[model samples]
Target: MILSSPDPAADPHVAAALLRLQRTSYAREAVLVGDERISPLLEDEIGLTAWRGRWLMAWDGVQLVGAIAWWETDDAVEIHRVMVSTSAMRRGIASTLLSRVLASASGRPVAAATGRANQPAVALYAKHGFRAESDEQIPPGIWITRFRHAA
Candidate 1:
């Protein structure tokens, strides 16, 4: 797999593909979390293009398979999204994307959140040295686990 930063302005197709992948990937998360209104699934391509994060896309010989988006702050990097195509799950793609993002963070803390019921995501973050710091409730019943990587 090849990883590259995609410029949405130069390639609108990347944003469209990312939106499709986000919906497809997050649908499973929605089921796991018992919430059909997870942010990724509710987002549209227009909103995706307007997002203020940089994306690292994973490609398997020209096919978009996964992506990780993040924004850098003064002292922390906030990971907005980490998505792998449903067909590409369990292939180490997400881990690879996360590794790249962490490397690019240049020692700043990294923060991310996942649905509380999304065990795979929680485990993935743990594997990368992130610790569960807190939990948040959105829409009343849905719980999200916030994680932070300080290394």
Candidate 2:
């Protein structure tokens, strides 16, 4: 496995690949949360490039296996997305990507959110020293659990 900081904004092919990865990954997340309207599932490559967040990608010899995207605020690092292709599951891709993010946070708080029903994601955050701070309801019944890694 290799990790890279691909420029999705500057590279059309990278953006397309990232979009494909995001859709496949988030599609599973939508099923896990039982919500077809999850925002990530609806995002397009154009919308993706607009956010301008920092990204760390994990590759399996030319395959875009996983990626984590985040934004840096004045006092914290807000993780927007952590995605792993369904075919690449159980191989530690998400963990490796997240570990890299936490290591580069430089003591600033790192925040992330996942569907509250997504136990695997919650466990991953906990394994990396993140604590569940709260649960939010969006569009009424769907629950999202927010986490924070504070050093």
Candidate 3:
């Protein structure tokens, strides 16, 4: 696997490719959480291109297999998304992408949220030393757990 960082605004193809992977990956996440209205499921290429965050993309040969997006806040790295194609699951792509972000965090803590029912995601964060900090229920009773890794 290979990793790369590319600005979506600087490359329309990057935006489109990420959008495709994001949709499928989040679609699987939506199924895992029993919620079809997750934010990533609703994002489009325009939304992706408009995001002012950094991205780390993973490639298997020429295939775009995974991506993680995040931005730095004053005290932490706020991870917005960790996505891996359904066909590429269990290949350590998500872990690799997330580790890359954590490595570059520069002593800032890391924060992320995932559906409370998404066991794989919850376990993934736990394996990376992130602890569940809070559980928030959005409208329609969808619960999400926020995680934090202290600096």
Report residue 9 deviation for candidate 1 (angstroms).
3.6
Model 3 per-residue lDDT tens digits across residues 58-119: 98887899999999976779999999989999989888989889988978999999999999
Alpha-carbon runs more than 4 Å astray in model 1: none
| Cα TM-score per model | 0.96, 0.96, 0.96
Residues 1-151 of candidate 2 have per-residue lDDT tens digits of: 9999977999998899999999999988788899978888889888999888899999889999999999997688999999999999988999999988888889999999999988889899999999999998975888999999998
TM-score of 1: 0.96
lDDT (C-alpha, whole model) for all candidates: 0.91, 0.91, 0.90
Higher-lDDT candidate among 2 and 3?
2
